[model samples]
Target: MLAGLLSAGVPFPKAIELADPKDLPDKFRDFIVLAFELGAPLVPTLSQLEVQMRHEERTSQEIDQAQAVPQATRTLLIWLPVVSFVLAQIMGLGTFSGILHPVGALAALLAGALLFAGYKISGRMLNSFLAPKPDPTLSLMVLRICLSAGEPLEKIRKRLEGYPDGGASQLVEISKRTGARLSFLIDSELEQLNQKLLSSRIEEARKLSVRLLIPLSLTTLPAFLLLTLPPIIIGFTQ
Candidate 1:
């Protein structure tokens, strides 16, 4: 059905309207909706659309995989304390006896909680990393600089294609997707993007984040050694 729509040069939104929701894959539905809403231009080169679709699908699958694993792990972690307590009781070990004594059991419960919390925090961080944050003014400035240096839009896009973290490249990609004129899009969208980035408060947050990383990494090594060295030394002595 999508192929037929492409052949007929039907707009994506209209094609989606014509398609049966039950017949369409859930993953493709959002892309279809976005295309329709944005009125994304059709690339003459069908191969480009194919590649983009595949990349998006792969990314979606990877995110699903990550979410699935963590959910399953969390469920198992939640059961640990309950299971440990039960087993101790069943084995006739006093509540404060066995490897999982009161203190050890408390530590286990805390570790499990920390693990689940860490996973949730990391997932949010990963989503933030993946979502595009194109700054329109900065993008326009970059484009103008490139153009002044004798580069065309297409050439500039190609040059920045490999700049994975570039805000300008993200704006260009949005233009490519929407079939909008890059310059016009940049001018119209710059203010909105700037507002969003500012409201997110990421700049101040990033400064603090960067300052923490070095100290965090530095502290980790000594802490890890302190925790592990005694066990290693005891094993060797035995």
Candidate 2:
């Protein structure tokens, strides 16, 4: 509807001013208000946002590909006990009967708990690393474009409030207090900022890959022994 209004030659600010605020996202409203206030072209700014989102998507895909092997390895490790149990039964080792002794059952119970905790912690850590953070530079670009176009401070604040944790809101607030141009923070350093953010994320993913190994090993190694050793020990004793 907003697009249709813009296509009808209605001013960007006026189009938003006439529409219900409840219908629009706070950040989106900032774009329209900024364009209307400055008579700036919203298309190019929106296009930039699209490009940045695409870059983020590509980065996430790369991380997933890089992490796939470790994830598959964990899955197999989790199923190792079941495979061992089935194999032992086929061999008539009857190791499970031995494992049912009071002391043996207690040991098995303890091992199962440890395995559960390890996998849960590793999965949580992996997800935390995989989760995308809001693009810090994306917000800065929005704040700069709006402020440079002389968008209203109240309007900017209202829109930026949607993502309070982002750099855009904080930068705009700082600029307002300092009476500095928002563009001053981004105009020259924008590319550098983008590069820095990308590199930092890649580095973080790399470190997380290493951290994941510790938990996976802790879980899988003990599980390997618990499942494979008991039956062998029983067969030999008999």
Candidate 3:
């Protein structure tokens, strides 16, 4: 039924509407419910998806910056303690022969402590580096696209009604308060909104969101592969 509605050029939300819940598959019912909750209006959703694509592109670029610093710092932290321990053992060989060098051991301990401190500092900086920036560009783009796609401000507001999850919801409220169309709001007042909500860190925030995709992708792939693959690869070979 959904396929039929889609074939007829109906929007996903509308298609779901046409297909009664009782007639639809359980999996499809879940999809429709999610779509409704996400405030789908076909064209608006397409526009939001486009914005997400752009965000992904920007995020890839930022990932390069994060990888160069944080990743290297984490590597250093992991290897430093092991290297220090090995070096101490190597130098202590003379101590077993009654030739202990207190100065050398102290130097090794100091070096290890310095390395550990550097690792901790770098880890903190990296955490800050990946934190999200409050960029209204995505929200603005979504609003513009929804308006351009022939959705009235009122209808858009209605769709976003009572949604308080920030971003989309906040914009919807702004539109209601200002009594301005989305295009005008974005073109004329988005900068002011940025100033008010993001202060001076807007660009940094945007960069961080972009950078996060790299680590997120790196982490997600392994987990996804683990979940998808069978538990046993080779069953007790003879």
**TM-score of candidate 2 versus the correct structure, residues matched by position:** 0.63
Q: How many Å off is the CA of 76 in candidate 1?
A: 4.4
Better of 2 and 3 by lDDT: 2
The CA root-mean-square deviation of candidate 2, after full C-alpha superposition on the true structure, stands at 6.4
Q: What's the TM-score of each model vs. the native? A: 0.34, 0.63, 0.41
lDDT of 3 by residue, 40-152 (tens): 55444444433444444455566555456546545644464445444433654232222123443444445445545545554565677657654445445445555655666
Top-TM-score structure, candidate number:
2
Task: Estimate the lDDT of model 3.
Answer: 0.48
For candidate 2, the per-residue lDDT at 145 reads 61
Candidate 2, position 210, lDDT:
74
Candidate 2 weakest ten by summed lDDT: 45-54
Clashes of 1: 0
Best-fitting candidate, scored by lDDT: 2
Model 3 clashing residue pairs (backbone)? 59-210, 133-205
Better of 1 and 3 by TM-score: 3
**Order by lDDT, highest first:** 2, 3, 1
lDDT of 2: 0.64
Q: Candidate 1: misplaced stretches above 4 Å?
A: 1-3, 8-14, 20-47, 66-81, 96-238
Task: Report every candidate's CA lDDT.
Answer: 0.47, 0.64, 0.48
